[model samples]
Target chain A: MTKLFIPLDSFAVACGADTIAEEFKRLVADRKLSIEIVRNGSRGMAWLEPMIEVETPDGRIAYGPIEPGEAETLVDAGVLSGAGHEKRIGKVEEHPFFRAQTRHTFKRCGITDPLSLDDYKAHGGLKGLERAIGIGAETVIAEVTDSGLRGRGGAGFPTGIKWKTVAEAKGARKYIVANADEGDSGTFADRMIMEGDPYCLIEGMAIAGVATGATKGYIYLRSEYPVAIDVMREAISRAHQAGVLGASVLGSAHVFDIEVRVGAGAYVCGEETSLLDSLEGKRGQVRFKPPLPAIQGLFGMPTVINNVITLASTPEILSAGAAAYKDMGMGRSRGTIPIQLGGNVRHGGLFEAPFGMTLGEIVNEIGGGTASGRPVRAVQVGGPLGAYFPVSLFDTPFDYEAFAAKDGLIGHAGIVVFDDTVDMMAQAKFAFEFCAIESCGKCTPCRVGAVRGYETVKKIIDGEHPAENLVLVEDLCNTMKFGSLCALGGFTPYPVMSAIRHFPEDFHGEPMRVAAE
Target chain B: MVFQARYDEAEAAEIIGEHRHLEGPLLPILHGIQERFGHVSEEAVRQVAAALNLTRAEVHGVVTFYHDFRKAPAGRHVLKVCRAEACQAAGGDAIAGAIETALGVKFGETTPDGQVTLEAVYCLGLCATAPSAMLDRRIVGRLSEAKIGALVEEARL
Candidate 1:
């Protein structure tokens, strides 16, 4: 029987995919259709989610953005036979969005049954772990180091260096913690990985355990992603049962086990140190560094804390030789980066491309311009902590150093677009308000300066001595940038300063000034 | 008006006992208590503190630090509207305004009848399908004024 697929991932579910899937299933059952229904993960082309795929003789035929009401029309069109239909988007692999991506980490995401270990292995799943075990721990670290894999968790730190630190640190027990607290507004790659191919994350962590001699691992996931949490919990239990995890992983002498810890609603907990604190059942506050997480972390033991993307990408680096992975990207950003296009974009989804793709190419060409069909005004690359870039800077390539050189960051590679109607001054103000709301309150500059910065921005918006207020806002941003303990306060200036500098027009027109005059 | 619910020590103990064996049990225990009791009460905090061999202040600090944990029971239905940039780009601001007007309350405020509570969440990771909201635990995306109204009506029942 031909297999019919529907996405049960949260993104698809949000678009009422569950209802559509149920209706489709019911319709098929009523019609006595011999098609077998399979609930799969999203294809990352979220614009066409609830995308149904049929295993045709040729390939997987794709149709999408299906609603519950469209079930009857789909049946009438005989979609099971892969016949022509209005929603049919041709072969799944032939779609421009999927075709353009150099998907290494996300290869198995939308392909295999997420819960099936056999499917995972068939699709080149545990090859990395098997390779790592044969090569031994030192060789695994060497391969990662030679591959030049930097932390995909916005910081861009070298992954090999971090593992080496934990390996060398004198501790009886070390821990590998995956930071799954994906609180970034425009980013959801981590959630997708955990939900789509959870086994990959498990294998990656197990490999880390082998390399660092850390026996235990923890994936600190945010509470917002209930689907990811459930998927990961189930995947971890299955891994343990299958000997892929717990006491001799993959039949090796190395023993490694993983636990899924849920974070309460704290965005700062996404920060490595704060995540450790939250994992320890304390307030999600930033801790002073110097005894950085590598040396002193997680109950004062040496820790290997990396982002979800960083860990998930580990298996690929191990399985494929370091040189093969290194040959893909330009400059220092070696390997593929999953660029999340979101906000007002026409074709918003996850695009995993090699580095050096300019912002203009991503926003205009691949993204298909604004979703509202309006003139694109500004785009915020990275998370809330990233700078807002105008159309003039669209030529900036997707590289960590390149963005930093332009006073911007390719943080997590999340691009949130804005149209002509957006108010940059308001966006600047929201940055401060967001900081004020989510501040850990451990430091003075972030906790108090953010509140002051909000008031100053408000004054500027009100045109209350616009020139002076603007200067004061600048000074406050500097103080927060320099004095803040963590990235929460340090990077808030990216949005605030970039807005004031690039879009000064929005900060004008104060009714209060006119009234005073 | 603020709505408060009394905490049960027995219930708190049961919740704590369920998660106390985990490596770091405090977060799990707190989450359990909040999930079961609808909020972490002062009495529940004291009970958890006693059970975990910690101070009530520490427990209270943790409860108040995270935005997810509520101090009192929410309305029967919790409506979380996305106010992040992605949603805003999709006219979420206007949708939020219409919701406030229709519900006769601002964000974080529950209806006087205690049927619905409106809250503002940063992002629900549904940027591709912009203008999303979560009613209770279910995500509703690509919302419009009429759809939100229907959702509110259904939530009230």
Candidate 2:
């Protein structure tokens, strides 16, 4: 029987794919098409789904965002016609968007059954966890270290270093945390991981637990990812029932349990310390450093907190052997990162590539320029905290050191591309405004400076006190950068500074000509 | 809007006792009560306060901290328009303007009719299909001027 996988991602919700899925099953039965159609999570490309992939002798042939009218023709066209459609953009793998990626963590995304453990297992799912359980924790960490795995969440910290910290920490009680607070604007890779392959995250956490001697784990998820929360909750309960969790993990004495704590909307909570605070049922506020979360975290216990991509990659690194995983990237940053390609881009989705691809290749070659077919302009990497890199910096490699050298951070590897029509000034104002809104209201510079900065930006845009306001904005940005308590305030300058420095023309109140017209 | 904040000592204890039988029922029971009372009631707070061996202030502290755990009633309908960059890029600001004009209420303010409240949200992850809005908890996207008006009309009935 041909297995028909229908992606049930949020885009599917927007596209009304659920009704289509039920109708599809009914139609298949009526038509007596010898096929098995399964509803699964989308393949990350939101524009292309409600997209159906029909199993054929050759491979999975695709169709739609399929309208009811086209469903019959899809099957009639040999189901494997892999028919050329406007949405197809031709072969799935042939598309530069997917081709540029090295999808180790996201290998099964949009391709396999997101809800099926059996399909997951068939595609080398629990194999890494199996090896980890078979060999024990120390070996698992070693394999990860050898694979050169780094946290896919911004900061690019070595995953091995994190696991080792918790593994060696002297504590009877330990905690494993999954940072599912994907607060970055252009980022969706973390959400995709949580939504699509939650099992990978679970197994990765289990391995961390067994390796580090931690017994309890918590996945601190943002409430925005309601679907992820629901799916992960269901997956956790199933894992518990299957003995994948509890006292005997995979029938071993390594007893570790995991729970999901849905975080109220707080961007600051994405920070490890704030996340810990929120987990303890406290306000989603940031705490001062000196006691790093890995050391004294979550009820003052030694905690191993990692981003979604880090946990997901751990399973693959162990299963595929370390060298194979390590052979991808350059410099200190290694392994694959599932970069979220989005915003005003033509071919947008998730691009999982190594650490050293150029922005030009990514935005132009991979993304195919602007979504509206305008001339390519600026691209923002990282999150809101990241700088706007003009075409001048497109030659800059995506690695940590390379980007940092150019005064930008890779952050979570989210690339937001914009066309010439984009207004940098408004975008700059929004950054300060966002910081003002989400700033947890902890410290003065961030709390006061953000709103002040927005006001100054408004002044500049209104063409009031142009010279003085410009100076004021710059001075204010510097203060926020140096004085703020956290990245929320400290890094708001990247956009503001970049807009003023690289694209000063944008902030000059409509260029005098456009407004008059 | 119905859920009240748990404020007093005895009330907190009562609240905790009320939700004791639920399965790992601390958050759910608290949320349920909060939903019903606008915020967790004082009685509920005190009840939860006692059951968890926490102080009344502690319970209140947690409730007030989370933005979702409201201390007062919400309008009958909440129209949370996404203020994320993707949506903003796709004309969210224009949509926000139309909403403000139509409802005569600014962001984070409720209507006098108790019918609606408008608030700003970061990202709903509905960027690919941008210019989205969340009516209550449902994510609604591909939003335009006409769609927003139609939605308000539908919610009226």
Candidate 3:
């Protein structure tokens, strides 16, 4: 009779959504009401998590941050009729946070049952696969090329070119590897898609297989995401049973299937080469490029490795056409980027907007500033390796090339805000420490240089030869930036150097005052 | 105390056999072994190496490389606190200190009664609710001193 939706996404679950769901089930049974609860993926407005939506004749009504104890009170107040309660935040789509987002890739995430193929197809799912299968492999690559989709894994390489390279490369059997190892700290776009809308990723990977003539696909997911791992495994099995996977996909002659491989807790495995090595049951180490993964990859066969978001965006690009997808954003970044706002922000969640929104709008207007109610000191755009942008650079637009021009990276687009109380010196040290911990030790610059960087920053923090060590730190960073094999060592200097550049007062003689006294 | 059924070579071999058909079966087999027993023992490594037709050094290297694999049994429960930048920005240092004091054990150490083992993790992707931690597969976020105290008490049980 009546239907209620609750999120099964990990973030919601962590916030006690499961307990609240159970409470609702018990209350419904006790009252003998004709009500049904559907477990849906999160709407990404994490602040209002454990958010329950009730389906009415008009539309779905939303209420949230529902504590387990409040379920009884809310339901007793005739929540089924979409009655006004203090918790009711009206239709979710009308909310400021949801309204502002462009929501191209994440269109169906917060809505629909993630596992139901009928629901997926009902909400514009398999149109892309059908279109790809109809257009043939060459046309699929051409469409992707026209869409201007680049690697969302932070490299910004053209996805169409990669597929074309794999398609023409001389190989009897090719492979499609989805780099789902989302180890970046403030990033969870990959995790959300995998848990919320797995078929979207599965469909994208299948399209890649059809386009590249690759039959086998593997999703190298991180072990930290146990819930995503479980959801994906079940989703893959369901896809196989429904003919979305396995031989003769959707009754076509294009034989393609997918497998979910878990990564051992190695952050370095996020690198394409390191992920392939880990997939082969070897130590997760980076391999030198000359022959990139597109040419020789995954057991020495040409492999098309695309990030979760990059692959997930394809279903829409194929369904909506390349021009529709291409016309949304500014310049080269011609699509919606799912920017994850976290840390000390008041309204921390995923904001999917087209490129060209200034950092000021994102932090102040959308995020509503810090949760601590203090003046914002710095915002770290990207992950641990990304630079810390001061308030002065808040005018910088959310674009790939723009961030690079600012001597920073839009890596994975995870913007973490910090209040005025943050210590930039400690943050600088952490940049090096994180590198030292996660480095694959492939190159001496990353492995040893990181340790030295950490120690050098520590010396600066202790006010030891502050002038001399600052120069030493700069020289060491230059060495690592030039000599390192991968971004793990190369880009680490972004945070370290940016901290010194933007907030020099923190890095000099302040902590030593107590010792001097 | 940590519940570890004595390591059986036959059981380890059976788990290894289950995954041998897949491409790159070592990591999965090791995961299977660790799940069966609390830790990956030296003898288990030897059996896996022999079964996979690889050197013992190779298997050992893999086990050591990844942070997830354990060489010995842990306490009854494992607690991992987030140490990444996002968490650090959200009073994570205070959370870390409070948990250590509450549990009477440091990051990589187990309590005296073998009740809980505390460890530090980079991130759990719960940055939205910053200052997060995972206790025995259940994630607790937006952590404060009181929440962590309760978590420590739950681990003891």
Which sequence of candidate numbers ranks them by TM-score, best first?
3, 1, 2
TM-score of each model, in listed order = 0.97, 0.90, 0.98
Interface C-alpha root-mean-square deviation, candidates in order: 0.9, 2.8, 0.8
State the lDDT of candidate 3 residue by residue for A1-517, as single tens digits.
8889888888888888889889989988999988989888889998788788999987999998887688888988988889999889889999999999998899999798888888899999989999999999999999999999989999899999999999999887999999999888889899999888999999999999999999999999998887889889999999999999999988898999899998888999999999999999999999999788889999999999999999999999999999998998778988889999889989988999998899999999999999899999999998998999999999999989999999898989998999999999999999999999999988999999999999998988888998788888888988999999998999998998888888888977433221111
Q: Go through the candidates in order and give each one's DockQ.
A: 0.76, 0.39, 0.81
Task: Note the chain A TM-score of all models in turn.
Answer: 0.97, 0.93, 0.98
TM-score for the first chain of model 2?
A: 0.93
Query: Mind giving the per-residue lDDT tens digits that candidate 1 earns over A1-517?
Result: 8898887778888888889888888988898988888877778998888788998998999898888798888878888889999899989788898899999889889888888899899999999999999999899999999988999989999999999989889898999999999888888899888888999999999889989999999999998887889889999999889999988889999989899999987989999999999999999999999889999999899999999999999999899889888998889999999999898999998899889999999999999999999999999988899999999999999999999987899988889999999999999999999999999999999999999999988887786888888878878888999999999999999999888877877878421221111
Off by over 4 Å in 3: A509-517, B1-3
Among all windows of 10 consecutive residues in model 3 chain B, the one with the lowest summed lDDT is: B1-10
Model 1: what TM-score? Answer: 0.97
Q: Which fraction of the native contacts appears in each prediction?
A: 0.70, 0.33, 0.70
Q: Is candidate 1 or candidate 2 better by DockQ?
A: 1
Residue A362 in model 2: shift from native, Å?
A: 1.0
lDDT of 2 by residue, A127-245 (tens): 88889988887898888888888777787788888888878777658899999988887787777777778788998898888778888888888776667788889888888898888
Best by TM-score: 3
